[model samples]
Target: MNAYSGHTYKFTKEDNTFSYIKVHIKTQIGVKNLTRQEAVKLAGEDPDYLVDDLFNAIENGNYPVWNVFVQVMSPEQAEKYKWNIFDMTKVWPHKDFPLRQIGRLTLNRNPQNYFTDIEQAAFSPSTMVPGWAPSADPMLQARMFSYPDAARYRLGVNYQQLPTNRASVPVYCPFERDGFMNFSDNYGADPNYVGSTLLPTTFKTTKQGRTFSTLTEHEKWAGEVSSFTTEIGHQDFEQAAGLWAVLGRDPGHQDRFIGNIADHLSSVTYPRLRVMVYELFSRVNKDLGARIQTATEALIA
Candidate 1:
């Protein structure tokens, strides 16, 4: 059972030597949860509770950080993997592909201007430099197109011109000339298209002679995209069941999950939707679905 928005990406080197990779960020502090009662109390008493907690920690020099991880399945591995590597919902089990910690991202510095710095900053997967690339997760592939389209609309075509979103190094784009708020001398005398003597482009080459112009059949997936459907059976429930088993290992997590879901599901007046959710859960574990259904019905009544 796989659940992923299939998006395609390529990871390339200076000589255009590349591999396919999917990236994940895990919080160093691990996941934390608060009860509904605690959340309500915090909301009524101190709406800025989370922000305050974060600020206090940083100010006291207890910086929060995240562990950067990548689930790197090579082209060969991707072809023979049990589950679809492109599926987002299906996680690459750490047992098989253990995490390789590349670096830490610390939130040590707070922004001086929340608007110009944080609010106006445009983050897009497409903004990645040469080394990092997107994977063949459909959702990720779609975001590559959607994100920049949004940035262009929301912050203008020259959104990259904004100080917060601008790259540290200079960016050249002869084609991106004459948009709203156009201030740059748009590539002075460079040619926009290829085969121009005005500005000839030379690509970097590796010692082994691999150049940027080379393309492999495996890299492109044979041009036209294909759509295929698969049957979902026990494999789909395996992960959810494993999650339930782990929750059982913890004395109260299963109850907590049921209670949390019930609290929100009770507000949804549509009975059929509630039944559908329970039916979906029942496929994973009969007891869990029953427990959640009972709790949710009681809440509604």
Candidate 2:
């Protein structure tokens, strides 16, 4: 199946020139889906079927691969886009910005040990490479902080020192030291803070274009500071209506979409909550909302 980062990020340069991007990883093998009945049966028979299949495939030399691509839009294009470019839920239409293949990702090996290789692993959006940077998306920002915080809570303060999470390249941070489980030399006797004339810290400056910790000058908004949160309006449902129309192209896809909603929604015990759901879907399409309500009521009755 294909995977998406589902959050807007930035492809940036040292000069502060950046383009908004959404990362996509398309599997070499086409996507396949089972109906709700089939999925429930499979879950009962073998809950770990998908993971087992992936591991077996890799062990048998059938390495799973995905083509990594990015949909890019210039800063100018973002301003003119129909939806807010920073909205995580809104997908940038492919017609406007097509996929550009960046690289290939392959899974060739299984973990040697579950505790060391799998359990200790940690990943965060903030741990980005030089050319790649984060955007102003609220969800992305939350993950950038929450993911690392969760890792630290689950693992330890020096969780990054673990073999699975450690950086291969040299990292120079003299201030971050003496934490629990710290395995390094603790920077020996280096100065914790750098402001002395006798000894100077060799820091990577802006001229080298390596200072990616914050947004560049052009990226910052020049207005008064205010917190941002997405507010729903009728316009918010337009893209959803478009998607419902697209589902009609495949004969049973629309039915499957309705069924998927009904199967889960029918389990809700609260009648008021169900009505609220129906009203939400009504914004997308009246027919869609009616169909979902009928199917759910049938299951409930």
TM-score to native of every candidate shown: 0.84, 0.89
Off by over 4 Å in 1: 1-10, 13-18, 189-195, 202-216, 220-231
Q: List the residue pairs that clash in candidate 2.
A: none
Q: Which lDDT tens digits does candidate 1 get at residues 70-121? A: 5555667767777766665666776877767666778897778879998888
RMSD (Cα, Å) of model 1: 4.0
The list of candidate 2 runs beyond 4 A from truth reads: 196-214, 222-231
Candidate 2 residues 1-301, lDDT tens each?
Answer: 9999988888877766888799999999888888989889999999898889989999999999999999999877876677777776689888889999999999999988979999999999989777687777778888999999999999999998999998898787766778899998988877776666757644533435355434645356411111445677887888899999999997999999999999999999999999999999999999999999999999999
Question: What do the candidate models score in CA lDDT, each in turn?
Answer: 0.72, 0.84
